[model samples]
Target: MAKWKLYWVESDGYEDCFVVAKNSRSARSVEANMNGFDISDATAIRVMDIPDIFEEKADKKFRDWSKIHAPQQANNPDLHEWPWYADKWLLEELGAQFRVIDNEEQILLRDIVYAKKPTGEWYTYSIGARAIYERNKDLPQYDNYDNEPRIDISKQLYTAMGLALTQCHEIEFLFSNSFVFAVSEKQKKKYKTFNDFFKGWEKKTLGGLFSAMQEAFDIDPEVKMALDLFLDMRNTLVHGITTTERYDINTDWGQKELLAFLDLFLSLCDPIKDIATSCFEVSIEIANTYLLKESDENIPIKSSNELLSLFINCFKLKSMN
Candidate 1:
C-alpha cells in the first residue's frame, strides 16, 4: 500500500498530467486508462514513491494525497515541480558516489557521480546540477536546468569536488587528532593546523598517511593516487587552467578518457565513505555499550573485549577484504 505519484507529458508538448496510484506500474496503468491507449504508448512518464514525510524537504504536491478526486483538488500544484526527489533517487539508483564533508554545524555531501550514457549524454543527477540550480536560479539560461543542465557538467563537477575534498581534509584533521601520536613541546611550536600537529609527531607526509591506511586496512594504492589527483584538479579548476576540446564520448579516445575518469572517481570515494560511516556507527555502538557495561552486574566479558567485539562486528566486511 505504498503511495506513488506519476508525471508525464505528451510527446508533442500538447499536454501534461499527473496521477496517484498504489505503486509505479499502477500509475502507468492510470495514465493509459486516461489517455485511451496502451501504457506502453505513454511518453516521458516517470514514477516516484510519495513517502509520508515528503513535505519536509520536498513540495506538497508530490504527496499522493494531492490526488484530484474533487473540484477543489483540480488546480493543485504541479507534482513535476517537486524539488530534489527525482534527481536524488535517480543518482542513487545509478550508484552515485557521495563524500561526507563533516563540520561542526552540519555535514556536507560531495558527489562525484558523473557518468555518461552510451549516446554521449551526461547524467544530470549530480552535485554539479544542484550547484548550477542554486547559483543561477534567477538567470534566464538556467530556467529549465533540472531537465536541461549546463553543456559542460564536468566543469561544475570539478569545482564542487575541489571544495568537497578541501572540507573533507579539514574534517579528517579534526577527528584524527586523538589517534595521532603526540608531538613534543619543541615540535608543537611549529604546528599551525591540525594536519601540522599530526604530521609533526612522526615527521610524516600525506603519503605516509596513505601508506599507514593501506597497511592497516588493505586499501588499494590507486585510491591514494586519486586523492592526490583531486588536489591537482582542484587547483586547475580554481585557477581556470582546465582545458576543453571537442571529443565525442563514443569515440575510442573519448571512451578511454570517460572510463578512466569514472574508475578513479569511484576508487577515491567508495572506500573513504565506507570507513567514515563505520567510524560513526562504531562510536554510537560503543556509547550504547558503555551504558550496558555500567548497568549489568553479571558481565560475561571485560569492557575492552566488549568494545573490540563491537568494532569487529561493525567492520566485519572490511576484515574479509
Candidate 2:
C-alpha cells in the first residue's frame, strides 16, 4: 500500500490532505469515506506519494505527518498553511511525483522527456505522441529493445524536421516584414496597398527573400550557408519524400539513408540557433531604424513591433528547459 498525499480546493482555499491506499482511485475513495463527500473528480485531485520516511512513522497519522512538514503562515509561524502546500511543500520535497490525476496529465509526465545539448540548450518532445498512439500505446514504455531504437529515431527525425521548418518560416517572415519597413516610399508604391505589398513579399520563397535581403544588408556567410542548407533539406523532406524512392522504409539501404538524414538534421541545431539569433538582431535593427520612426498613428508599425516582441518571448521560452 502507498501513502497518497492528495490535495484539492475547498470553499475558501486549498485543502491539504492524505490517505493510505493501494492506488489513486482507492486513495480518493478513502478520503471521500472519511470526509463524507465524493472527491473522485480526476481534474480536481492532485496526487503524490508521501515519502517513505514520514509514512513509516508509527506514532503519527497521515494528516499529522503532513502537518509536520507544511509551510508556516507569514503572520503566525506556528500555524501551518494549506494554501502553500501545493507550491511550497511538494515542490521542495517530492517535485517529480507531483501531478494531477488524469490520463492526459499522466501521459505528459511519463511520455515527454528532454535532452540537453552540449551547448546547454534543451529540447523536448512527447516521444512522437501520434505515432506511438497509432503503432502501439504500450510502445512508449520504451523497454522493447527491438522496436525502441527505430521508433525513437523516427520520432527524433520528425521532431528535428518540425523545428527546422518552423525556424525557417519565422526567419522568412521576419526578414520579409522588415524589408517592407526598410524599402523607400517609391518601392512601396508599386503595390496597390500595404496589405498587397506585404502579402506579395511574404509569398516569396526562403531563398528568394534571403537574396532580396542581401541587396540591402551584408549577409553573414555562415548564417546564409546554414539557412540554404536548411532550405535544401526542407525541400527534400517535404517535396522529395512524396516523389522519390530515396527514403523507402522497406529497404535496408533506404533505411540507412533516412537515419543518416536524421543525424544531419540533428547536427543543424547549433547553426539554426545562431541563424535565428542573427535574424532577430537584424529585425530589431530594422525596426529601430525605420518602423519605430513612423508616426504613432501607423497601425502596421505598432503591430510589427508587437509581433517582434512576441516572437522574442517565444524564442526565449523554447531556448529554456
Ten-residue stretch with the least lDDT total in model 2: 100-109
Misplaced by over 4 Å in model 2 are 1-156, 180-196, 292-321
lDDT of 2 by residue, 87-139 (tens): 32333344222222212221122233223334433333333333244335554
Q: lDDT of each prediction vs. the true structure?
A: 0.40, 0.46
Model 1 bad stretches (over 4 Å): 1-155, 167-171, 174-203, 214-271, 277-321
TM-score of each: 0.26, 0.38
lDDT of 1: 0.40
Which structure among the candidates has the greatest TM-score? 2
